[model samples]
Target: MIKQTQKINFGKRSGLEVYPVSMGAMRFPEMDKAIPLIRQAIDAGMVYIDTSRGYGDSEIKLGKALKDGYREKVILSTKCSPWVFKAEDTDDSSADCTYKRILESMRRLDVEYLDFYQVWNINSPENYEKATCKGGMVDGIRRAVDEGLVGHIGFTTHDEPENISRYIDEADWCEVILLTYNIFNQKYKDVVAKAHEKGIGTIIMNPACGGMLAENSPVIADAVKSAVGISDAVEAGHRYLKSDPNVDTIICGITKPEDIESTIANFKKPAFDAAQISAIEKAMNKLSPDNAKVCTSCKYCMPCPAGIDIPAMMDVVFHDKVLKVPGIAKEKYDWLTGENNKNASKKPSECTACKECEAKCTQNIPIAAEMAYLARREEQSWK
Candidate 1:
């Protein structure tokens, strides 16, 4: 069982105390249909709210919703697009004009100071140069700290694990690190441990693996061995990080109150038996190096009103996981529905914005919104 809350104290010598759980507002306005959801998260003791300029209008509404003294109660962190760090307007090479961008993010956030201001998407060597150059991004971050415009300088990355490990080793100035992490995508396995050892706060991103695991709840359960495994499935994931002791927080993207409840419940009893962890490993191996679908494929989400078999959709999605491929799944999707006569069924267009499917979706995919987008974009002639 989880013996404690998920939050941990971060040191950059920065006195930042936050909930072990953070709300990533990347899907802000989209999920912002109900402002109460945001309120619910904060009310639940989620003190960390992460946002980025890349996520259009997310930070804006986040700023708006965080009114009524909400700002003082929480730790607000946001990132600047890498484009801002570039000197030329047209060119967006890896080198960052970090010094200038932090100032802008401050203006955009309408804050005198930010708890953390990261160089958004600084995931490659080119990005490394931009941020850490002699007169690069780090200089600006340091200046911001001196100027009292930002508290600490952090960076988020999606680079290959080994390479990122090297960068972390070299850039001793980094106080916090954000990266893609989850059961399905455990690329930074060791580096995360290493970062914590270095006293750098490890903030996990993509913990849900893009809603892939939410779909496969029964599979997730069945895959776990009763003995010798981690604790609960949710805690299983948390335990993976929490065990490291270096991880400061897990920044999960949550759009509803239920997600917050579920996440907190896991924290309540975070435990992982050796056997359960092994089961998950076996399941991952079965997923294979190739032709693997990370989602557990549990039909927790049922009754999609469009008769859009959710599991079946994932089945195909798993197979055609290669985004570059215009696979049979797309073909099937088109055949099932569209303006042209096919199965006398609904196309993505047939979806109404009632969002009934969203509430039922274990993964909580914004189906109605997605369907509308897919339906409206059929002009390429899918004949």
Candidate 2:
């Protein structure tokens, strides 16, 4: 199919008119921090709000902020893990076990039905079997839509470019793809092209790649400042992604009210010029490690059955082997997957052969196997 260049001439979807940008409240916003920034994003014509039951009280904070008719303005989206799906096992599921998670999310956000309810992350190696198989999680999404708890269905992934292509092709029913796609990631453009061809909405995450593309990215930052008339480096990153006609919205993880202001202001800035794209990539390439693909410490792949924090583990491996973020990576390795949570929960040493979490990953990562490697290494290191 020829890629659709229909271009989003309008800024609205599922009853919400919005700015091209959206707000993602996943990280901690200090003090009483979350609400103000959330409000600021909405006030700036941001019509879509993305949160999750897994995102550390983000849904509740969004609920508080969206109260008093604030719900009327934008589309609200959240996700359900795919690990809960099963045919004969309908009586129980990770989703139903956590259906209260959704109920609580809605009650807190104060919404009856969500504009979009997504499958959180499908970066797992198992891919289809875990999410779409008879008992897999996608059925739950289909059921949720049938139940009218949600209006549209979508999902987000953090998979490799090639796997992302196959995943999207398989998940043709999904209306949106919340992908961690950026200029630095070339594998996504093909999948994104497929999405546009399908009329499915596209949302970009890590547009700033975990805040690593800030002022320190002087080369790309300069190009961005010059192109978009924005002084902040993060704004430059956002602008680079916005210029693409296929992108429906960029979900920025804002931890402060000022981050909102900075993001919104970038939207008002001019579009990218030919020079800017070159400069942006070049700067990222320069400031970034030779292989920026090193673990970014983004816990997108959480809820490890073996109790491994996949991203954190990747970070430790990446830092020690790649970016070298100092002793913090080693410290994280000890605290996160270590005995710290052993009594409270299963640790990385407990991975069952089921590989349930590996199926839904977007990056198409081999999570279960990686955890095995991690466990083996831990024993070797005697930590």
lDDT of 2 at 372: 73
Maximum-TM-score candidate: 1
Candidate 1 C-alpha lDDT tens digits along 321-346: 42212344456556555564433354
* Candidate 2, residue 17: lDDT: 34
Per-model CA lDDT versus the true structure: 0.64, 0.64
Candidate 2 residue-wise lDDT, 1-383, digit = tens:
11112225322333233457777868847537767667767767666778887676777788788877788877788875634232233434344533444565678677898887776677775754566667456666666677888787777887777787777677666777788777556457677777766667778887776565552544444645654466676666777777777777788777766667667667666768877777666655543433464444445556766555566666556544444333444555677744634434344567775666557555556766666766676677733
* Worst 10 contiguous positions by lDDT, candidate 2: 1-10
Count of residue pairs whose backbone atoms collide, per candidate: 25, 18
Q: What's the CA RMSD for each of the models?
A: 11.5, 9.8
Q: Each model's TM-score, in the order given? A: 0.69, 0.68
Judged by whole-model lDDT over C-alpha atoms, candidate 2 comes out at 0.64
lDDT of 2 at 357: 59
Report how far residue 138 has shifted in candidate 1, in Å: 1.7
